[model samples]
Target: MKLSHALAALIIAWFAVFGRIQAVTLEVNQGNSTCIKAELTASFSITYNTSNSTRTVQVPLPDSATVDAGSSSCGLDGNTPWLVAVFGPGHALGLSFSTNGSLYSVANLTLQYNLSDTSVFPEANSSDVVTVVSSSVGIWAPINTTYRCLSSATFGVGGVTVTFSNMRLEAYMPGNDLSPAESVCMADQASTTAPPTTTTSATTTVTPAPTPPGTPERGVYSVNNTNGTACLLAQMGLQLNVSYFSQSQNKTIQELVNVTPNLTSSSGSCEASSATLILTEGRATTLTFTFTLNSTSNKYHLSALTLLANWSDMTAPLSASNTSLNYLRSTKGRSYMCNTEQTLAVVPSFSLNTFKLQVQPFEVTTNQFATAEECQMDQDQMLIPIIVGAALAGLVLIVLIAYLIGRKRSHAGYQTI
Candidate 1:
């Protein structure tokens, strides 16, 4: 009867141990304020005080979700908990706890899970409540529940959180930094126009001045002696009839011909009787004459003379004699010498026939004389002077002859007394 009681106690203890191992719980929290729809993950740890038996745990997951176990030896250590890796779409997680233990021994069990699958959450919403339950404890537990999208989880400053919509995350890895957004529009531009151009021109002008007038004119001529005729004598007077653009006019030109006499008898004498010529009106023209006398040949000829006269038919002849117009036989008994002179005159109506007078053999000589008009002006020049001794001798002879006649008359008176 005591063995029976012991066996019954062991069977009751085995059932109680099994019940404790089957208790499990799960919970979730999506920590947000906006509306969100997303999945949740629950991880579990199981603790059991049992011996000689194995327990198995099952954790329910959402459709299309997965479950995986962490290393089994992790559950053996009291501090190392078991892990249930969960993946799913709902806001709740599922966990199952199981263990192996002996009968009639008091056994205690604890369950632990890893809530790692966070991708099932709706990325746009807020946090919501999550519940956990255990059949062995007959209780529902509340945990602070939060949901996270795995793709949107960010790790910062010792914790992890879901990145919100419209919030940009810029991360700096080892190589390059993140870039910022750019701007859109631009500003306006500026404008201008040039001023109008101008042009100008200038002109200049000039002019000039005037002038004046000038003087008058004149002429010249010469006379020459040629042929055997004597040269026109120096101081010989002549008559020229000249006309220039007018009626003919007459003018007296002085004869420059002369003779010098040498007498052998005290009573013998020679004189200049005539040396002149007159021109007739129609017969006075251009002619020239050379008056030279050759006593040895007894020939008297006139040199060809050119006269500046108005008429072409003018002619004249030159003559010389011992008396006024007659030849004297007694003048031949005395020796006579002759010479010539040259003269010039310019009259308004006169012309000159010859321009020069050339006397050849240069030694043939001539003498110059004053004109007959010049000679008549001074009579003292015409008279010859007597010597003082000759005058005294004549006076003495007259006085002596007068005194002898007076003495003869006085002696005849004394004889009568």
Candidate 2:
């Protein structure tokens, strides 16, 4: 009887161990039945905040067996097309189909990433590689970076978020801290998703993303697309501003641009973005616009999208009688530079809803604002002369008082010199 009882206990223990082993196998690759390659989808894009370097990552389908369906707006990183810049594992990428549309889905995921693992990425352990994963980008600089991924990225903090995974992650350097255009590298094994462009035939009607409160519904946007690689010369004030709606986010943003750019006469900072432009003349320059659209008939309404730079100039203020238009005409050797490009109304009526600009805020080289510390320093600098003058006055007053006391003592003394 004792032997039979012992034998039965041993059998029960063996069964419990076997069951545990089966459960462990189910959790492999996040419970993926079969590992499948990742693909790029329209729902993928990258956006960076100039204010903060907090990157919100959503990529890499956990399971190749199950794929999600969705789309996102992705094109034009400022002037350069997104496909040309955002590529590979370093930048944020979007993946679509999984294992050629298998019956699997990434039910849940717990991404364990060391936010600040900045050891040179893609552990290419090929003897000459280093990676640095950084949590706080304040310290790490994504130097000599290249943007490459399988799919394109949208502009202006795009709204489309995909459920699947696989793609790249870009560097997050705040406010030109480290090469505004540079991209941060991603570590290997982390970038398990490859660049594969595959899509489903399902048609998705995407609704516009929410807009900020008080955003204008319509207007022509000015942007800085033409200031290719030109450092901003000076800053001027803009009295007039133009605006456009971003289809990705359905929000209106300010920008500067000309239907037909007269680069010679455009002064200050004439750069373009999808949504905003800076036609700053570093000095106050009154921008005037006039256009003659040759419609088949004479049914054309002429309007002007005049942009007046509103910022103060480092140099002398624009003349109260503003001779900027006259100056541009003389310098560019062109007549009618002041002929009023458009009438008082916008050149293209908002009703037409054509002619909009794009804004790759990350790619914007100009329109930069001074930091708090920098502004404080400027204040200190301006007060320096005043401080020196006050010190001199105090010294002179002390000297004067001393002289008066000395003269009084001499006058009172019996012996004089």
Candidate 3:
């Protein structure tokens, strides 16, 4: 028992030393006054190309990062104030702010990274350093109150994306304690421009897939086994619509937030009779899809679904799970396919849409989907086209018979005359 205790202590010490520590606050000074005081937490998703393939890496802002007071400056002449946090060689986090009336917002975020640095990118191959910039983060706060958002918000420029959450920021305030947040970030406050859709022909227009109420992007996700064989595959757009009581804002509200894919923050496990896909959308939301196979029936189905949402308004994150699901069933080797969009109300606080979805949980041979089992929605959609075609055929037959009878009557009338 003594030996075991000593070993446990050593393990604890090792973890303390190796575990990543997150910084709580950052202060930038200009001349004799504090320019900015931000308590921020963010994670970056960067897509970079290596010598052989393209990969995405997620890295959090480390605690060791420090403000660059020498290069940072306060706002002047209607220009925004900016702050820079330098972490390591050739890597930094930069932010610029915008002010309107009594509110202030983050206008731009610039991320500089070095691909050759193994400390930042574990799969570094080349020595190229690049900067990715995102604009209009939509975080706003009143001048008297610090801007705080517990919900995660995502924005991206090209291949670089940032998910900002749990932030408390005050700009141009000196020698004052941070006040409570009265106004938080909301999607309606941000500027959004929809892209124009292209068509194959003048008569053929393709409709884009529907995303969740507040989410913007969708993706296809896959989980592989140890031998590099795919064990589970899914394609869908997800969003979490939930209601919570905000203690700081003193109100109860509902938020519909998008669930974006974080490839670097996801994991999966596969067994002979079961498979699980665990996907994360940032630091705040997690989605778990569990599937099981039944050999006796030669079929597989989604057996359970779990969603965890961490909202700042609540004391603890809400966990919504449904284990009684028998949805998305298919043959053991076939995939469940549905082209129509659907909303799944798993629970009151847990609802999402699986848009343009196709999933195969087990027996994914050749890294491709086999024959598919059409979902109820797809089967129902197929009947609409068939019904329309049959109705048109019947209308044409009636028109032809009417014309023939009119001609026969005219001929009989002429011969009798």
Candidate 4:
């Protein structure tokens, strides 16, 4: 047959150029240049081997990448492979070498565009090679594996636009040969609001009153003299005892008495015996006889008894005298009869009466018989010779008995002398 069909077409073109030179090496161990407004993921992994028979692999991404080609199994001679992918946004997926009659074979490539500036691959200009090569592989086999591109674009340019409200996103991949894939965009932390505070208070008071209680708040007889006799004889008669005598309240009544009499015979010839008279009633009183008799003993003895004696109420009856003879003569013509027996209480009891009287012989060169026997012996010593002839002998016997009865009636009319 035409040389066995030319050795089976040279063993099927060397088994499709040795399965595209032993393909299955797609490594963008991480890639994403731009293309994440929201949903985004990009990863790469493929290490190949399928010469002894088992194979089925495919891994390509960047259409705003996304992939979970985990749990894969592909073997031709074990060198583990078949981790496949192809995901969203202006894409470029790499690592290809198909076996089912081969047609896809590209070692590695990763490109993700469209940070949406109206898409169609925009927003990548910071050095602008943000990777771009989609599906036109084959230039001196320069697509040979190994890649790592991580880019998150939210960059603003001329038309400035950046917005992410309350956003947070963090990613880190550790296995399946994407050794460096990290992303973080977190912002959402807010809380605030304050103002309001106040307080105050005050008070005062006083009172008092009530008090009262308190109250306590009487005591005059006098008499004095040593004595010069303020005469006070009180038997209630002497003007009622001198009206209660208070001569400056005197007090010295040691019994007062003062009497003095003396007449020792002035004319006597042979008769003159009448001496025994004593009277004392200085201040002791029951008065009845306190002698008085003075008008010359009533013209020498006509005796109308001018109180010759009274010893306070004696029995009243006296008149007895039998004359004989005597020298006790003080006469007008011999008259000396004395009687006072009102039961006499001593005027010497009338000299114990042994009456003998009649001896009137008187001449002494007559001065009218010597003034009538010295006025009848001073009226028989009444009140002791008139308190001893005081008051000038009773005013000279009352002017000589009124001029001797007016000269005996003018000498009895010049004839009956």
Q: Pick the TM-score winner.
A: 3
Model 3, range 17-68, lDDT digits (tens) per residue? 3245464578777666776888877778887777688878676776767888
Measured against the true structure, the TM-scores of the candidates, in listed sequence, are 0.17, 0.24, 0.48, 0.13
| Residue runs of model 3 more than 4 Å from their true location after superposition | 1-216, 262-264
Model 4, span 330-402: residue lDDT tens: 4443323222111111221222211111112222231112332333333465667667778788889999999
Worst 10 residues of 4 by lDDT: 216-225
Ranking by TM-score: 3, 2, 1, 4
Better of 2 and 4 by lDDT: 2
Q: Give the alpha carbon lDDT tens digit for every residue of 326-400 in model 1.
A: 111112112212222222333223322221122221112332211222212123333324455667889999999
The numbered model that scores best in lDDT is: 3
* Alpha carbon lDDT at 314, candidate 1: 19
How many steric overlaps does candidate 1 have?
A: 66
What do the candidate models score in CA lDDT, each in turn? Answer: 0.24, 0.26, 0.69, 0.24
Candidate 2: where is the Cα deviation over 4 Å?
A: 1-60, 65-374, 414-417
lDDT of 4 at 226: 26
lDDT of 2: 0.26
The sequence of per-residue lDDT tens digits that candidate 2 reaches over residues 205-237 is: 776443433222222223333635432222222
